[model samples]
Structures are given as structure tokens and as C-alpha cells.
Target: MAKAKPNNKVDPNKYLKNKDIEPEGKLGVAAAVGRMGLMLVGIVGIATEFFRDDGWLKAALGKLFESTSSMMLIPVIIFVLWLLNRWMSSESKSETKKSGDIPMYAMMAVGAYYLFKLITTGSL
Candidate 1:
């Protein structure tokens, strides 16, 4: 019987315990989880708002986004766009590509528009 040699190379994440390979810090994990959780909550809230047909701008947004007033949408669209810009810029590539942030950003923009409307116009 012949014995086989073990492979020497391995994935650094799986093989190494060095400081550089480690996470920035424990708080990073907490912050990331918190951000993702908050995003999820926003998504679910809007999704719930959709099928109910009375939660506000859910249908209007999910549809072609036929808002009754453009004046009402202007500031909100601007603000949400700004927020999305900041959010997307700060995020890492893995997050932007794989973390589902784009769709989330889109949903957040819609939700934010309605939220802004809800706050300012007292309607959505």
C-alpha cells in the first residue's frame, strides 16, 4: 500500500490564525449584523405593507410608482437617493455584489420615499 502526502497549501481563512486575517474587531461583527437586521426589518415591513393594500404606498411603489403628486416625491426621491449613495459607497465590494444590498437599496429607496411622504404629507 502507498501512502499519500497531505496538501501543504490551504485557504488562509481556514488555515491561518494571524491578526491580519482576523476580523477588524468584535464590534465590527455586531455593527454589521445590526445593519443587516435593520435592513431586513425594513424589507419585511414594506413587504407586509404590500399585500395588505392599505399600508400606504406599497401598491403605488410596487406598481409603476404612480404617485398622485410629483411635488411630494421630489424631496423624498432626492433624500433617499442620497441615503442610497452613502450606503452603497461605504459598503464593501462583497456586500454590494453578494450581500443583496442593491435590491435592498432599491427597496429602501421605495420605503424611504413612502416614509418621507408619510412623515411630511401625513399620507403614503
Candidate 2:
């Protein structure tokens, strides 16, 4: 009896085997340009505010709030980003993941606390 040959055949013209999928160098340049554009817009906004004839002190205090708001938002943003990345990377599509909810809930609780405090203190 003749031995049967194993079927290991694959199509050579598949999309994965195509040579036209090379990474473009312009992608990095486009990313850098986008970042620079954001930076320029931010600088322009700040300059317009600072050079205005209105209250300089209030402008300065507004800057302080901007920085403080960003600091307060950083952890929440990080938690959300982590949760999204984890969900995206999970292999079990049918089952839902629940690892990152605690941080998000905690952040919300903290925000509610601050909001309540502000309202109680007549600062809101």
C-alpha cells in the first residue's frame, strides 16, 4: 500500500503574502505634525488669553485651574485607557472582562465627593 501525502498546500497569492503592505515612512512624519499642530494651537490660545486687556490675575488663576483640572483628570484618563486596552486585547470575545472597573468607580466616587464639597462650600 502507498503512503498518503499530507496536505500542506497554501495559496501563494494571499493578502498576507502580498509585498504591497510595506510600512510607510510618512506615518511617523504625520504623527509628529499632528502633535506639533496641537502644541501650536495650545500656545496660540494661551497667548491670546495672556495678551488680552482683561484681568491678568483672573487669567493667571484660570491657568492654575487648567493645570489642576488636568492633574485631577490624569488618573481617570489612565484608568479608562487601561480598561479599553485590556478589553481590546482580551481573547474571550463572548465573556466580558471586569478587571478595571474598580478604578473607574473609585474615580467617579472621588469626583462626586469633590462636587458635593464644592456645592456645600458655595464654590460651585
Candidate 3:
């Protein structure tokens, strides 16, 4: 007839002292979602403009912008997700690994492309 006693000496704060398990960096989801929402708003604006207009060419071009704007957001969204993944991963190799910074540049490139198109087309 032997009785076993439970160990009550485990300290929860001991885990907190370990830096390797701690989380770091920002999650890019909120930013990505916000950007997508802005792009959607831009698309809706373009669509409304098209429906309100009488010229076929102008309407078609407006719709192109509507669709393209959303398409352009796709890469940006992927980039954001990649960043969040890089931030949240705990593996040491993952910590040292870097995500492509090209998405930021891609956003700039898209902005420039749209600006150039708008200027050359004189559609604004």
C-alpha cells in the first residue's frame, strides 16, 4: 500500500526566461487586408464611373483599371503574408531567413505604372 506524491515545484515563469521561445516582429495581415480594402474601394469607384458614363471606350478603360487595381493587390497581399510568416516562425533557420523585399518595390512600381498610364492616357 504505497502512496505517490505529485511534484508541485514547477515554476511557470521559468519558460518566460527562455528567449528562444519568445515571439517577435509584426504580423502583416492587418496591413494587407487594409490595402486590399482600399483597392476594392478604388475598383468600386471605377465601376460606378463606368456605369454612369455614356462613352464605350471610356467605360471599358475604367473597367480595366478596376480589374487591374485588384490584380495588382494580389502580389502585395502575398508579400504581406510572407512577411507575417517570417515574423511568426520559431525555427532558428527561419529566424535568419529573409523574405523578398521585392513586394514593397512592386507596390511602388505599380503605383508608377498607373500614374504613367493615367498621365499618358489623359484619362484623369
lDDT of 2 by residue, 7-93 (tens): 989877766666767675898889766555544544444455557777465765566568767567667878999877876455677
- Identify the candidate with maximal lDDT: 1
Candidate 2 vs. true structure, TM-score: 0.28
lDDT digits (tens) for residues 87-114 of candidate 3: 6554775454344444444554554554
- Every model: Cα RMSD to truth: 10.2, 16.5, 12.2
Q: In candidate 1, what residue range of length 10 has the lowest lDDT sum?
A: 91-100
Q: In candidate 2, list every pair of residues with a backbone clash.
A: none
Which of the predicted structures, 1 or 2, would earn the higher lDDT when compared with the native?
1
Off by over 4 Å in 1: 1-19, 53-100, 106-124
TM-score ranking, best first: 1, 2, 3
True lDDT of residue 106, candidate 2? 51
Give the runs in model 2 whose Cα sits over 4 Å from its true position. Answer: 1-24, 55-124
lDDT of every predicted structure (CA atoms): 0.64, 0.61, 0.59
Cα misplacement distance, residue 36 of candidate 1 (Å): 1.5
User: How many collisions between residues are there in candidate 1?
Assistant: 0
- Model 1 lDDT on a 0 to 1 scale: 0.64
lDDT of model 1 at position 86: 75
Candidate 2 C-alpha error for residue 27, in Å: 0.8
lDDT string for model 1 (10-123, tens) is 776864556567546889988767566656656765666766756556645644345556457878988998886775564565444433467766665665666665678875
